[model samples]
Target chain A: MIVARTGNEAMAEAMRQVNPDVVAAYPITPATEIVQIFSSFVHDGLVDTKFVAVESEHSAMSACIGAAAAGARVMTGTASQGLALMHEMLFIAAALRLPIVLCVVNRSLSAPINIHCDHSDTLASRDSGWIQIYTENSQEAYDSVIQAVKISERALLPVMVTIDGFIISHGMERIDILDDREVREYLGEPPKRPNLLDIDKPITMGPLDLQDYFFEHKRSEIEGMNTSLPHIEAVAREYKERFGRYYPVIDTYRIDDAEVAVMAMGSAAGTAKVVVDRMREKGKKVGLIRMRVVRPFPKNYLKELIQGFAAVGIMDRSDTLSTLGGHLYVETRAVLYRASHQPPIKNYIYGLGGRDISLEEIEEIFEEVLEIGKSGKVTEPVVYKGVRE
Target chain B: MPSLKELIKKQDLLSGGHRACAGCGATIIVRQVLLAAQYPVVVGASTGCLEVVTTIFPYTAWKVPFIHSAFENVAATIAGVETGYRALKEKGKIKEEIRFIAFGGDGGTYDIGLQALSGAIERGHRMLYICYNNQAYMNTGIQRSSATPYCAHTTTSPAGKVIPGKPQFRKDLTEIVIAHDIPYAAQASLAYWNDLTKKVQKALEVDGPSFINVLSVCPLGWGVPSDMTVEIARLAVETCFWPLYEYENGKYIINRKPREKKPIEEFLKKQNRFRHIFRHPDRDKIIARIQKEIDRRWERLLKRAG
Candidate 1:
């Protein structure tokens, strides 16, 4: 049954449904409620799971890796510097194919050291071999976590479900949560892979791969990721069938017959969607495309989706290789490289380091997209609605 | 009387054919520890010489369920694993008896990993953490670590005209672990396999967190011949440089003692890292001071064990 709950409660309920055997976590702001509510379940005997109170974020991820390697369903939550501290093990977890599911309360990486919402933390760990999914709100946070576990176990790759810190992690909202039995039947039992700890059939995992075999091993990881596309869609379909909530890997809001589309992710997409709705009411042919799965690229899907658009304004909270380019712009261009009907893409680097990306700012970005479509070559990178120097 | 052999499991959890360097004391210690553990044991290994050598992608040497976490989180990882096992057992999901053990190098345990180790012990988790004290970071090309003995040459702390080996003395990780007042803490070496095995078995039998500091000799790091690894470790104990002892419930017990104490130079002469000390007579005073410090610590341990 659907119950109105906050993101943290939705996450906790989803974890209860997944029934992870071990939950090792340390409390951090924004991510604490996820663990706090889960701990209550452990205390009340609502869930038969071990709740480890680790000393630091490093230990939290380490403990999860250990439990996961030992053939137990393991989950943990962290943010910002905590995610950075767990960076090394994240790669190990993926390489080991442990199927660990991590809920990342997305926080800004340090420098000015803000603890609020941003995509930089998860963005920095893009190449860590984890299948990353960005959630726009509490409902997505809960729903995506269940989907993440199914995808990770099926692909034999770890998954990270990211919700913007404070914006979605701390923001209270009504979210639908499926019953434990329904979730159990939907996700089924975690697929039995060759675990590191199985005594009867002993298998060695995480072996040293020198230059000779390292390439092949890396290629296999890529193969596993490539294989995840169908499995992720299948899991999402299963979730929708069981719980009556639909979520696509890439959710397009009013993009059909549109001249301009704002591409973004996380809670910023919510604001962008509102701006798109307002622009549509004013007789403007603009829409929003929210990227759900950031990793495994979804290049082919994006190429198909952006085929008929006149101009695509890619809004990113992260910078890419080029000074003026954003990560979204780079991926979008790479996906649309040989397409016949590729749109003229404009890069907009905004909402970095937890700075507010309000609805007004999204409107301003939409205005830039309109101006750029008319001019053809308006400006390089066009830092839209940026904080004035 | 229970036979010491009966205390060990017949199954070889950490098998052979791994890519550890020849005469690797750390590899031997891991095997010994695994043999001493009961069935359904979970192992948490830190990133070190043994971990890097054994777990290379899709090829593991470990027969038991093992995890290789970051350098600083082995103890904490094991503690969490133990907690999971406890919860599972209480819920009747896990019916078999299980033990949790963590392994780390001196660089990981004595320095970078100390905080996590401290937290695990303080939390009183049922696990055993063994620090294979190989003196330096052998995995990372023989860099200087806090466990490197004073007057010993390393890649980072090389003996030169201006500087003669590492200036700081080795950190006493055994004493530091013991100070936490855990039920069990000990120091062992590769030279005494039976004693090391017995200590591991005893640590596993304990209900709370136990720490073992093993003087694992690294031939390549110390610039000694691979064949002399065992002899080098033996001389270390005979010279009283690494005392073999155990602390149980506030009581100190020396497990082994040399019948005839050897001179520090005998141990120093085997390793090329310390060869410079003997060549220069001006460094005699430094060697003498190190010898004196070893002697003092040994006397203190003996008195406490009494």
Candidate 2:
């Protein structure tokens, strides 16, 4: 049914439909309402999930890992520092191959300590062997979470579904939610894996590995990610076939015949789309590419997408502070490296700590990229967009 | 409760031939607790001597379903496992009854993991959290932990020329756990197998979260011979330095009160960690202070247990 819901509301509704076996989470801003609403569902007996009101985010992720390893469908939500607190357990979860779903409301990391929307939290955890899916709006957030359960289970790797804090988490938008029975039918029964709860065939998990087998075990985990691309695509395809909304790893708009393109992720992609349409009406050959998945880097599809464009502007909500630009910018550049025709890509670090990214700034960015496309050269590679001197 | 003969007949959950140091009290404590559990149990261990030694890769001493998460969150991890079992059983997925237990060293339990333990118990998970209190961090080279007794020498809190051994008193973790008002909380010693096993059985039988602090003795960390682990542990109880007690349903029960408490020097002089206390210039005053503290605590415990 079509209903107006914020991103957090959409995620909570999806979690309710998923009706996981256990949810252990601590409260954090923007992401707190997702677990808060789900806990009420558990309280009202809408779902038979055992909601663990853990003391801290560290325990929240630890419990989720324990629950998932015990062979239960598990879900939790956190943001910024909460995700940062869960950093150590995140690697353990991925290394152990527990299919736990974490809903992250993207927020900036500390120092100045702002709870506003930024990609620093999830971006910093990029190498932690998780399947990261960034959503553009409330609808995408709802769809991606439901899809993440299937992907994580199939890949045997944990999945992180992120929405921009406050922008999507608090802002209400019209979204279509699937029926509860339909979601259950789509998800089907939980897989029977070798779990800690098994009595007759008892198994040991998360044991210490020394030099003898640690490298080989890590290599196998890398192989799990290496071979997960098809599983990710297959889940997205089946979800589209059943639910009628398709979300690919790399989604594009008006990029069929464009001289210049702007790449973005998360909620700002929605703003970029409007700017793209306005620029197109003004007869400027410009388009937009929104990256949905970041973890299993989507190198091949990204290379194919950025093939013909003379120049591209990459928008990053979080800076690496390494002077090498933001996470997306650095990774995208690495992915495009060694290509026969290298596009002069400019990195636009914008909207950090939830500073607004307006249409005017994006239009200016497109104009600069369009100029770069014309000259086939780049003067400045990395620009801290919209920041005061 | 099973007799000693019956318990011995039960399958050994923790297999032998692991990498633990000889006479490691934590391993013995684990064997005793697992033997006492009547139901099929899923065990979790925080990063510590028990975890690293028992479950080295390519070889795991654990015969039961086991998990070793990070250092400070085993209580939370097992709480999750218990919650998972409940959820699954409610869904008619798991039919059999399975108990959950978590093991942590003194460092994992009293210091870094204390918050997680408190939270798990307060949330009322039906699991048993056993802390193998070896007084210090035994796995990472004898560092001082909050559970280290007063004036005990550790690598971090050495008996240097300036300041003696560990200056602070050990944290009474069992009392702290009792304040959570859990269904069962107890202090047991590795030397007393019967009392330790009985407490484990009682803890596993409780309907809500239970905690047992087992006073584990580390031969390496305590600077004692491998064969002296249990004897040193027994001296700790006899000297009234570490009492055997239990708190259940708002009642404190002193299980083993020494008939005539031994002098603190007997317990202190056996280990090299406390040897510095003997040769120090203020040795008499230091010994008196230790005895005074032990007497004061023992009297308070007797008053409560009465």
Candidate 3:
């Protein structure tokens, strides 16, 4: 069915079709409407979902851990401070190996309390052991929520589906939503595991381990992440065949033989895609790559995606507060080191606190990358896009 | 409800092979609560000694489905499980009746876990949250908690040169939970098995959220001899220091009131934690103040009960 809906509404729409056993969440800006709308759906009997309106996001994720541990397909949504509040439980959700789907409407973390779009919130929790998937538009946002359930459940790890808070969550767009029956059949029954609540075969979850087993458990978690990559690819393939929506680890646009390429994640990628087309029309060899599955950190796909580029401009919506650049920039550089070919990569930090990055700014970034391509050297590996200094 | 003897015989859900401390009142409370539950239960424990000692990988004593989540949020975790059970039952998935119970230490319930507990109760999930109050954070080695009583000596509230013990009185967490206006809330003690078991059964039977603050004993944390766990806890109830009461449907009922209340000194002197107050320069003054405060609180509770 085709409908005009905001990203939050579309996520709620997908949730209705997936029909999880329970969803626990606390209301927070930008992401609040997702659960609020889902609660209304429960009230209207649109879905048989148990909506747990928890007082805080910490409880929200904690509840998801319990529900998911009981072998129920569980989900929740949060943004910014909500995600931060859930930080401790996020690791527990992963370590307990429960497949709870978390929708993160990416927003800036607070000091003075900003509610705008930034990758800081999710990036800060990147090591929480959740499979992080970024979406560029409402359609991908909707699709990710559905596929994330399968991925997380299959991998026995929690999944975080993120989109820019104000940019995508509140912005309305026309997209094709799956038929409820199709979605139901596609998801089918949630796979059963030995549950914490199962009376017949009781199992213990999240026990303390000091020296004997902590290392082994962590190594096993690393194995869990390694095992999820193929599952992600397989699910994406099945989704493409069923819904005609294609999502690879990285979405490459006109990068086949480009001399200069720009990298973006989430909504900024769409804005950069427009600039990519404009630069190509002007006879400039500039392309764009939108990274989708960041948690598994598809370094090889990224290395392969930027294959023919001489100079690449990596646009980071959030700064990592580290020595040189953002998290994506550092990881991208490190990954490309083993790629058999190293491109001169320049990092561009932009769109912080919902700061708008116009097409002209993106065009200028491509021009910079082109200049770097000519020189074959990146004098400034990191540049603040719109900052005064 | 099962008779005390019958309940004792019912397969011990918390098995014997686990490693709870000797004369651990919290573990006994867990066992009794499980005995009274009518439905098959899934137990959740906060990150504490009970959780750490019981399910230390490859040697879990929990015969029933048990889970240990983060230290705080045990209530939230069980609330979520209860929510899932409702959905599953509605979908014709769960046929048997299942109950959810969460256990937490004093620190887990009264301090960091407070918000999550409040949220879960306010949201009205059908589950029983049992706070095994041992006065302080016994899990992390007896640091003073909000549930730690006044003038109690803990690691954080050491009775040293300038101070007595924990300076302030313990926060009334039972009243705090009652403030949410949940379906049922109560205070019980491990020593009062009949009263505690009855309250646990009623809590499990409640259709909405229920909370029980079980004033449990801790040999290590409370600095009492292991054999004195029961004696100390019984004296606590007899002295009105930890009253046995219940609140249901907006009405309060004092379940067990001592015919003649005993002196608070009996309860205080049994524990080494309170050993210092007896030798302090102002010993008489402090002991009288403690007795007077207990008397005042007991009278206030009686007025409410009346």
What do the candidate models score in CA lDDT, each in turn? 0.82, 0.93, 0.88
Q: Write the per-residue lDDT of candidate 2 for residues A1-389, one digit (tens) a residue.
A: 99999999999999999999999999854345889989999999999888999999999999999999889999999999999999999999999999999999999999689999999999989989999999999999999999999999999999999999999999999999999999999999878889988889888999999999999999999999988888889998998899889998898999999999999999999999999999999999999999999989999889888978999999999988898988888988998885777889999999999999999999999999999998988888998999996
Residue A99 local lDDT, model 2: 97
Q: All candidates' TM-scores?
A: 0.93, 0.99, 0.98
Give the number of the best model, judged by lDDT. 2
Lowest lDDT block of 10, candidate 1 chain B:
B1-10
Q: Model 3: which docking level applies? A: medium
By summed lDDT, the worst window of 10 consecutive residues in model 3 chain B runs over: B1-10
Q: How many backbone clashes does candidate 1 have?
A: 7
List per-model TM-scores for chain B. 0.96, 0.99, 0.98
Where in model 2 is the C-alpha error above 4 Å?
A29-31
In model 2, the clashing pairs are none
Interface RMSD of each: 2.5, 0.6, 1.0
lDDT of 2 at A112: 88
lDDT of 3 by residue, A1-389 (tens): 88999999988888888889999998865455888888999999888788888888988998898888887889989999999999999888888888989888988888758899999999999998899999999999999899998898789889999988888999999989998888899899988887865688887777777688899999999889888899899999999999999899888889876887888899989998898888888888778888889999997778777756888889998888887688789889889888877888999999888889999999999998899989998787888898777
lDDT for each residue of candidate 2 in B1-306, tens digit (9 for 90 to 100): 678999899999999999999989999999999998988999999999999999888999999999988999999999988988998998888999899999999999999999999999999999999999999998999999999999999999999998899999888888889899889999999999899989988988899999999999999999899999999999999999999999999899999988889999999999999999989999999999989998998998899888
For model 3, name the residue pairs that clash. Answer: none
- Ranked by lDDT, the better of candidates 2 and 3 is 2
- Better DockQ candidate (2, 3): 2
